[model samples]
Target: MPYLAHIGPIAAIVAGVLILVMPRLLNYIVALYLILDGATRLLR
Candidate 1:
């Protein structure tokens, strides 16, 4: 539970790096981030 608090910032950082490395993956990364964010919020 404590580690779950860090997931958002960590995921954002990873997504940002992935986007910078492969611009074409922007869409997928954003979508996946959104889905995960929504799922986490819903679960909470």
Candidate 2:
């Protein structure tokens, strides 16, 4: 599978859990995720 295919599900699960456990982290998680995703794509 392509990296993005894995990223979606993993990010979703992590974001979901984090949102439930620590709502404050939602923004950071999303920002980190986008940054990582963009970096990954650019680096690839």
Candidate 3:
């Protein structure tokens, strides 16, 4: 799962940038991350 491992940091960075550049996107980014994370965990 090298791709998955690589994406984790990239996602974090994107979320960080979104938070910095447009604070409004922070909530959407966080919600998306959480939903995806939960889905992945549950599916696994």
Candidate 4:
């Protein structure tokens, strides 16, 4: 998970793994990813 060095990246990786375990969580994960990414971009 070297690519997932940051909190956001780590969350993304965890989300991906969670999705594999429970496909229903994909929507939530993607939504969260987008929200976090958007927040980071906007704040930065």
Candidate 5:
């Protein structure tokens, strides 16, 4: 499979695991994701 095809699911699983392990990190993770996502969209 192409790497891009796997990225979404893998990212979700990793994020879920991180949240489960460190609930406190949820805010940071979400904020970072939003920033990165917005940056990518703007760049594109």
Candidate 6:
């Protein structure tokens, strides 16, 4: 649970850096993020 709290910000930071490097990946990154977030919440 404690580690779960850190997953979000870390994911966001990584996503942000990725988007910056490849603007075209913005959509995919966002979609993946949303899907992962949803799955994690559901599991909890």
**Worst ten in a row by lDDT for model 2:** 1-10
At residue 23, give the lDDT of candidate 6: 99
Q: Which candidate wins on TM-score?
A: 1
- Tens-digit per-residue lDDT, 1-44, candidate 3: 44555555677788888899999888899998777666555554
- Please state the error at residue 37 of candidate 5 in Å: 6.1
Ten contiguous residues with the weakest lDDT in model 5: 1-10
Off by over 4 Å in 2: 1-4
For model 4, how big is the CA root-mean-square deviation? 4.4
Which residue runs does candidate 4 get wrong by more than 4 Å?
1-5
| Cα lDDT tens digits for candidate 1, 19-43 | 9999999999999999988877776
| Candidate 5 lDDT, 1-44, residue by residue in tens | 35545555666677778999999999987777666556555555
lDDT of 6 at 32: 88
TM-score of each: 0.88, 0.60, 0.69, 0.68, 0.62, 0.81
Model 5, 9: alpha-carbon shift in Å?
Answer: 0.3
Cα lDDT computed for each candidate against the true fold: 0.89, 0.78, 0.75, 0.78, 0.70, 0.87
Q: lDDT by residue for model 2 over 1-44, one digit each (tens)?
A: 37655775687688889989999898898898788778666765
Model 5 stretches with alpha carbons more than 4 Å out: 34-44
Q: What is the lDDT of residue 4 in candidate 1?
A: 66
Candidate 2 vs candidate 5: the lDDT winner is: 2
Global CA lDDT computed for model 6? 0.87
For residue 11, give model 5's deviation from the true position in Å: 0.5
| Residue pairs with backbone atoms closer than 3 Å in model 2 (clashes) | none
| Clash pairs, model 4 backbone | none
